[model samples]
Target: MMRHLDPTRLPTLHLSRGLVVAGLLGGVATASGIALTTTSGWLIVRADEQPQIMLLLTAIVAVRTFGLARPVFRYWERLRSHDVALRDLAERRTGTYAALVPLTPARLGARGRTDVLTGVVDDLTDVVEASVRVTVPAIAALVAGVGAAALTALVDPRVGLVLAAMLLATAVVAILADRLESRSQAAVLAARAEVARVVQLTTEQADELRVIGGTGSAHDWLRAAHVRLRASVARQSRGRSLSAAAVLVITGASTLACAALASTSGADAPVRALLVLAPVATGEALGVLTDATRALARARACARRLVELLGRTPAVVDHPEVEPPSRRPRGAWDPLRRTAHAERGTQGHPLRPHGTPRLELRDLAAGWLPGRTDLGPLDLTIEPGERVAITGPNGSGKSTLLAVLARHLDPTAGRYTVDDTDVTHAPLADVRRLVAVVDDEPHVLAGTLRANLALAAPDADDQVLVDSLRRAGLGTWLDGLEHGLDSRLGTGGLGISGGERTRLAIARAIASARPVVLLDEPVAHLDHPTAEVVIADLLQGAGERSVIMVTHHHVGLDRMDRVVTMQEGVPSHGQERVPG
Candidate 1:
C-alpha cells in the first residue's frame, strides 16, 4: 500500500509537473549566469582590442540582460519549488495520520507509546522536508548542469567537452558523498532519538529522579547519548566535506584546461576569452551539489524508516464475509437476549446492532508477541451496563486484555464477539470507535479546557462539558475556575495536579459517545483519597454503559458488578489463579 518501499519513490513524485517547471526556471537562471560571465568576458577583452565602441555595445547589453534575468528566473523557481514542497508535505501528513489511526496504542509500541508516536511525527516531517531540501535541489542541479554544458558547447566544442566532463565529475563526487553520509544517517537518527528520549524523561521526572538519587544515572545516559550523536554527525559530515573538496579540485582542473584550449584556438579574441571563462562559471554553478547530496541521503533515511513503520500490515482487519447487521439489534435484553430484534438502521454500523452493547471474550488468548500468551484462553462476558474490574499483579496481562478489547491487539486463539457475533475480524475502526480508553498517564493538551474536552465530543455544548467534568470528580474545581471551561491547561498554561489530570481523562471518556469504556489503571497514579473520589465520580454516570477497568490494586472493588483478578503462571487457560 506504500510506495516508499521502492527506495526511489519520493513524495516529490506527485509534484512532478510543478517540479519540472521549477527545474526549467532554475535551468534558465543558471544558463543566464553562464551567459553573463561569457558575455562580460567578451565585452572586456574585445574593448581592449581597440574595436569600435558599438562593437562592444552588443556584448555589454547581452551581459546586462543575462544578469537581470538570472535573479528573476531564480526567484520564480524558488516560489514554485517551495509552494509545491509545502503542498506535498500537507498531503503526506494527512495520509500518514489517517494510516496511523488504526495502529495507535498497539503497533505504536508497548512502552512510551507517546514517544513512539512523537518520533513518527518528526520522522514524517523529515520525509516531507526532502522535497524542499533534497529532491528539488537535485532536479535544479541536473537542469543547471545540462544548460551550462549545452551553452558552452554551442560557443566552442572543446570547452564544452571540458565543461561536460567537469559536470560528470561533480555528479560522481556527489554520489560518493551521498554513500558516505547515508551510512551514518541511521546511526545519527537513532542517537538523536535516544538523546531526545533521555532529555524528555530527565526533565519530566527531575523530581522523581532526584528523590530516588537516580539523577546521576540520568546524567550518565545523557552524556553517553550526546557522545554517540556527536560521533555520528561527524562521520555523516565527512561525505559532504570530501565532496566540497573534490568539486573545488575538479573546478580548478576544468578551468585550466579551458584556458589552455582558448589560448591555442584560432578564434577571435572576444570568443576565445568567453570560452576560457565558461568552464569556471560552470564549476561555480555546480558547487552547491554537496548540499544536495547530504539532503538526499537524509531524506532517503527518513523515508525508509517511515515506510518500515507505516507500511506494515495492520494488526486487525475487517472480516469481509461478516457484515455488521445493518442496524443495532433492537432491545433483545437491550443486547442480552440478542436472538432477535436486531434491525438495520439508516446508518451502517458494526454487525449485531441492537440492545445494550454486549462484549464477549471466549478462550481469547492474546499477547504482544507470538507464541507467548499473556492473557486468556479464558472466558468472560460484559453485558450492557456491567461494571467489571480485572485486577492482577504485574505481567498478569491487565493492560493486554484491555488492549485486545479495544481492538488494538488481535486475539491469537479465541473468539471475541459483540452481540453474539464473532468480531475478532471486525473492522478495527468500527470496533475501536465503540470503545474509549482511559489510560494511566493522561495528557492535558496545550489548549483551553473547552478545546481539550471538546476533542472527545466535538458536537457537545458547554453544559455537557461542565457536566462531564463534574461527573469525573472535578465539579468543585470547575466551579472555582474564573474562566471556567475557557481556562487553559498544560504547558505554558495552568498546571493541573495528578488527580486533576486523571479526572480530566475520565471526563474525556465520559464525553465520548463510545458505549464501552475501558480504563487501564485509571487511578493507578492517584493517591488513595483522590483515587476514591475519581472512582466514585467515574462510575456515577456510567450506569447505562459497560465499563471494564483493569488495575493491579483493588481500588473501590465493592462498587463494581464483578472483580476478576488475573494470575501469572496459571499453567493453563480458563484457570483463574486464586491465592492460597
Candidate 2:
C-alpha cells in the first residue's frame, strides 16, 4: 500500500526572511517610480504660472533623487532575491534525489522512467523560480498600493477613495488571472511531456521502426503531439491577455474619476494635476500582476507532481526490528578451504561472505502493482554455487522473479528464504549486500576505466580491478590500453562493442564479489556467437558465486545446471538438466 502526501506541507513552498527583505526593497523601488510621476506633473503645472526660478528648486531636486533611487533599489533587490532562491534550489534538488532512490524501477512505473526523472528536474526548478517571480512582485505591489492610497487620502478624501477602489479592482483582476492560469497549466505540461516523449522515441528507434514498417505511425504520433502542444499553449495565453486588457480598462476609468473629483475640489491647479497622474502611475507599477499569477499557477502544479512521485511507499520495506547480518571472517562456514578476498569493506577489511547461501522459494507470489500477480505460486530452490537459467517469453514474469531475488522488490505471498532465514525478516541491506545485478544496457558513465569499475567497490586497489577485468576475458583489451585503469571508456573516450560492454558489466559484479549474481537479459542486444562468448566469460568469471540468468533465448542454456521453462506467471514444464 502506498501513502499519499500533502504537497502543501512541503517546506520548499514557504518563503524565507531573505525573500521578504528583498520584497521590501522592491517596494521602495516601486514607490520611487510612483512618486517621480506625481512630483514631475506638479513641477510642470506650477511652472506654467511663471513663478520665480528659486520656487521650483525643491521639486527639481526631489524628482532627480527619485529617478536615481528607483534603479539602485531595484538592483539590490534582484541580487538578494536570486541569491536566496539559488541556495534553496540546491538544497531542494539534493533532498528530492535522495527521496527518489528507493522507489526507482518499481514504484516509478514500468516505462518512461527517464521521462519521470527529467520531469522532476524541471519541476523542482519551477518551484524554486516562483520565489522570485511570484513572491517578490506580490509583496511589492501590496506595499506600494497601500502607501499610495494612504498618502492620497490625507490630501482629499474623495480622490483617495477613488484610488483605493482602483487598487481593489486590480486585486480582483489578479484573482481571475490566477484561476484561468490554473485551469490550463496542467494540460500544457502534459502536452509538452507528450511531445518530448514522442520525439525522443522516434529518433532513438528510427532504424527498428523503419524495419518494422512503423515509421508512418511514428510520424503520425509526432504530428499529433505537436497539435496538442499548440492547442494547450493557445489556451494558456487567454489568462495573460485578459489581465492586460482588464488592467488597461481599469486604469482609464480610475484616472477619469480622480480627475473629476480633483477639478471640483478647492485645491490649486498644481495639486489637481498631481492627483490626476496618480492613477496612471499606479497602473504601470501593477502591470507585473499577470506574470506573477502565471508563476504561482505553474509552481503549484509542479509541487503537486513532486509530492505524488515521492510519496509512494517503496516496493520493499526494511523492518526496523530486524538487525543487519553480523560480520564474520571470510570462509568461516568452510574453514577447511581458504577463500580469496573479494571487495574491501570498512577500514580496508574484506566483506566476503563466509560461504554461499542456499535460496528457496515456496509458492511465492509477487507483483509490481497491487492485486496483480506478475510472478509465482510455484516452488523452486537453488543450492550453493549452482547455475540456473529461467527461459520464458515476454510477460512470463522472469524479470519480476529476478527483482525479488535481488531484494529490489517484496513478495506479496508465500515464503522466500536465504540460507534458512526468511527474507521478509531480514534487513533489506543485508539481503541486497549478498546479490549483484547485471542488465542488458549497463550504463557506462563518461569517465576513466578505474572510476567506472570503482562504482561497485570503491576501496578496491588497481590490482583487484585488473584481476576482475582479466577474469571477465578483458586481459588482452586492458593490455592494449595506453593508460591501463586510467583509460576512459564512455562518450568522447573509447568506444566499446556489444560483447565488451556485457563483459564489463560482468566484471563489475565479479569485483563486488557478492554471493549471487542475477543477470537479466545481459546479452539481449548481442548476436548469437557474441552472446555465447559473453555468457561463457560471465559464468566463468563469477567463480563459485551462484548465477541465475533470465532470458527467452537458448544461446547459453547448455551450460546451466538446470533450466526451468515458465508460462503465464509460474514454471509449467518439468525442469531439464544438461551436461556441461
Candidate 3:
C-alpha cells in the first residue's frame, strides 16, 4: 500500500505544456521590450540622416507597436502564469492535507505540532510562488536574450559574438547567485522558525513567565532569534547584490564591445545603432535572473522540507490480512447487562449506539521513543460498558497507555485486539471510528453551539444534539440558553467555565456515539467539587460504552467500575469495584 493515500505530488517548478505557453507569452513580452529599445535607437539614428517622411513612417510605427505590445503581452503572460500556478496550488494543498491526515499528532512530533503544521503551510506557499517568480522569469530571459543575439548576428557576426559572450557572463553570475542563495536558504528558514517559536511562546505564556520571574529569559530568547534572523537575511542578500552588480558590469562591457565591432563593420548607420543598443536591451530583460535564482533557491529549500515531512512512514499502519469478525466474544461480563434504569436510557431519552467492542491488551509495551518502553509489558481487558479509571504519577505512562489504546501509537510488543482480532491487521479508520478522545483543553470553536456539536456528528439532528448535551451534564445550561442550540461559544462569543468546557467535550464524545471514550485528564483544570460533578455526570451519561479515564489525581476513582494504578510502568489493579 502507498504510504500516503494521495497520488498527486507537491507542485515544483517543472516543464510542462501549460508552463511552455506561459513562458512563451512571457517571452513575447520580454522580446517586445528589447525590440522597442533597439528599434528606438534605429529610428533616432535614421531620423538624424534627413530621411524622407515615408522612410520614417514605418520606423515610427514599429516603435509604437513594440511599446504597446510589451505591456499587453506582459498582462496576458501574468494571467496565464497565475492561473496555472493557482490551480497547482489548490491541488498541492489538497493532496498534502490528505497525506498528512494519517501522520497526525503522533508522527508529526511529540510536541509543538502546531508549529510543524504552520511550517508546512508556509513552505507550500513558497513552493507555488516559485512558478511565477523563478520559472517564468528565467524562461523569459532566455527567450529574449537568445533572440537578441541571433538578430544581431544577422547584422554583424562580431557584435553578435560580443552579445553571446555577455550572455555567458550573465549565466556565470546567475550560477554564482544561485549557489550563494542556496547556501543561506536553510539558515534563513531556521531563523524564521526560531523567531516565530519564541514569539508564540512568549505571547502565549506571558503571565507564567512573569510569575516565574523569567521575563528576562524570554526577552533574551527573542533577542537572540532576531540576531540570527538579521544574519541570515544579510547572507541571503549577498547573492542578489552580486547578481545585480555583475549584470550591470556585463551590460556596460558588452555595449562598449558592440560599439567597437559595429563601427568597424560595413553596416548602415541605423543598423549599427541598433546593434550597439541590443546588448543593453538584452541586459534589461535578463536582470530578473537575480530575483529568479533567489526564488529557485527558496523553492528548493521548501520542497526539501516538504519531501522530508511527507515522505516519512506513518506511526501506525493497518495491514489486516482478513476482515475482523462483527460478532463480539463474551468478556468477563456482558456489556448489555445494565441495570433496568440504565437500560431505559436518560429520563426516557432514546439510547445512542452502544459502541461496546471488547478490547484486550496483552503484554503491550509501547513508548514515544524507540528502545524506551514508557507504557506496558502488561495485560488488561475492557468489556463493553465498562468504566475504568487509570491513575498514576507523572511519567508513569497513564497518557501513553491511553494513546496506545486509542490507536494513535502502535504497540512495540505483545498483542492488542478489538473483539477477538489483533488490531495490527484491523483497518485504522474502522478502529478509530469506534473511539472518541476528550482531553483537558477542549477546543470550543468560535461558532454556534449547534456547529460545535455538529463537528462530531455532522448528520445528527437537533433533537439528538439536545439529548447529547443534556446527558453530558449541560441540561441546565441548555435550558437557560435563549437561542438554544444556536448560541455561539468560544473566542468573541460567550466564555465558558472550565467545568463547562470539560462537559462540552464530553457532550461531543457522547454525540459521536463511539464505543470507547478515552478521557486524558479531562478534569485536570477543575476544582474538587466541579471535578466530582463532571465525573458523576460522565459515568451517568456513558450508556453501555467503554469509558477509560486517565487522571493524575484519584478524585473520581470510586465512581468507576475498576480503578487501575500504574507505578514505574507496572499496573496494579485495585480490589475496589462498583456495579455497572
Candidate 4:
C-alpha cells in the first residue's frame, strides 16, 4: 500500500487479500448451511414413525445456528473486503499526486491538474466503492452458487447439471454487458474531462465573461458536456439492467426445470421435494453477477488511468551529482569583503548584499513544453550588487522568461547560467536554492501566515520573519490583523487584498535570502504610496544580491542599476547606469 509502489502491484495485493478473507468466511457459512439442510431433509424422509424429540431438537438447533451465522459471515466478508479496497485506493491516490508534481503546466496543464484532482479524489472513491460494494459481493455470490450446485449434484446430478448451465449462461451475459458498460464508461470519462476544461476556461475568463456578456456561452458548453455524460450513463444503465433481467429469467427457468424433474422422478417425499428446490438457491446467487461485472469494468478502467499517470516522466530531473553549499553565510558580508569576493561569492555563497545580481540569463529561449520555444534567444546579464528591470507589454513572454530563469522552465535554445555555471543542465533544486521568485499571483496555502512563511525557510527565526515582513511593507498589515503572523489564511488566502497578497509573497521570497530573486510585477496591485515604499525597500534591501523585476510600470526604474527593454521576442536595448 506504499505510495511509491508500482501501480500494477497494488491490485494483485488487493485481490489476494480480498479472496482469502471472503473465501474463508463464505466457504464456512455455505458448508454449514448445506449440511444443515441436507441432514434435516434426510431425517424427515427416513422417519416413517414419529421421530424422537431429541432428534427434532438437534435439527432445529443446527438450522438456527446456520441461519444466524449467515449474516455474521456476510458482514465480516464485506468489512474485510472494504478495508482492502480502501487501502488500495489510498495507495493509488498517493501515487497519482506524486506523479503530477513534476508534470505541472507541461504534460498536465492547469486544466489537466484539475482533471487529475477529480480523478484522485472523486474517481478513486468510486473505484473503492465498486470494488468493495460490488466486485467482492459478486465474487462471494458466485462461490456460493458453485458450492450450492455441487451439493445438489450429490443429491441429484440432473438438478446440479441444470444449475451449472444456468450459472454459466449468466456469467456469459455478465461479460458481454460488462463490455458494453466499459465502452460507455470510457465515453463518460472523456465527457467529464471536457466538462473540466470548460469549467476551467470559464473560471479563467470570469472577468471577460462578465464584461462581454458571454456567461450564457459558458453555460451552454457546460450543458452540452453534461448531456454527453448523461447519455453515457443511460447507455451503461440500460445494458446492466438488461443483463440482470436475463440472468433472473435463466435462473427461474432452471429452478422450474428442477421441480418438474423431481416430480416426474416419483420422489413423493417432503425431503425429496425440498431437494428439488436447491436449484432455486443457486439461481438466486446469480443475481449479483451484473453488479460484479460492472464493478470489475470500472476497477479495470481506474487501474489503467492510475498506471498511465504513474508511468509519466518527470519534466525536471534532479541529478545526484549536484549538492547544496557546505558553508552558507548567515548575514551579508562587509563592504570590503563584498568587493573582494564579488564574482567568487556569487557562485556558492548564500549571504551577500541584497542589491547584487548573482543570476543572469543570456540568449535564453524557453517554454513549458520542450522543443517549442517561447521567450528569447537574446543576451542579458545581471552583475553583483545590481537591480535590473525587465519590461514588456502583456503576453510578450515576461512571465515565461521569469519562469525560465527560475528554472521552472528549461530553455529550448541559448544558455542560462547562475554564478557562471550553465543552469539549464544544472540540478533543478540547486537552481531553485540560488533564486526565489515572487509572482503577481501568489499561492497561499490553507494555514496560518507563520506556517506559509515557514514553507520558504523552515529554520528562519521569528525576528528574521518580522524583519522581512517590514521590508516588504507588511509589518503594519500584520499588526492590524488579529493573530499577526499566527492569523489563519483561508484556502488560497481568499480574504486578503491583491496588494496584501503580493506583500506576503514578497515576504516569503525575502525570507529565503537567496542570492538571486525574480519579481513579476510585484507592486502592480499596490496603491501609489505603499507601492513606492515597497519598491524603495526592495531596491534598497536587494543590497549585493541579484534582482530581476519584470513590470510595465516605470516607478522604480530610475533607481535600477540597469533597465532592459524587451520587444517582439528579444531584449532590444539595455542601459547600465548609476542610481540617481
TM-score of each: 0.80, 0.79, 0.79, 0.74
TM-score of 4: 0.74
Model 1 alpha-carbon drift over 4 Å, by segment: 1-15, 36-68, 109-115, 200-208, 266-273, 324-356, 425-427, 443-455, 458-504, 523-536, 541-543, 552-562, 569-580
Which model, 1 or 3, shows the larger TM-score? 1
Candidate 1, residues 1-580, lDDT tens digits: the string is 3322232243423447887788778878887887788789988888888987877777888888999999999999899988977776677777777677766656665325545667767777777666666666667667777877787788778888998898889888988988988888899998888888888889878888999999999999999999999998898777667789899999999989988988888888888888888877777778877887677777778777777667656667766764454544654222222221122122212123243588888888987766787887768888787788887778888888888888888888888898775665454556766787899888788999999998886866777677778778788999888899989898877899989998999888877646778998898767888888788888886546688898877687877887787776122244232332
- The CA root-mean-square deviation of candidate 2, after full C-alpha superposition on the true structure, stands at 5.5
Clashes of each: 15, 0, 2, 17
Q: Which is the winner by lDDT between candidate 2 and candidate 4?
A: 2
RMSD vs true structure, all candidates: 5.8, 5.5, 5.9, 6.7
Report lDDT (CA) for all predictions.
0.76, 0.85, 0.83, 0.69
Candidate 2 overall Cα lDDT vs. reference?
0.85
lDDT for predicted candidate 3 compared with the true structure:
0.83
Which candidate leads the pack in TM-score? Answer: 1
- Error (Å) of candidate 1 at residue 93 is 2.4
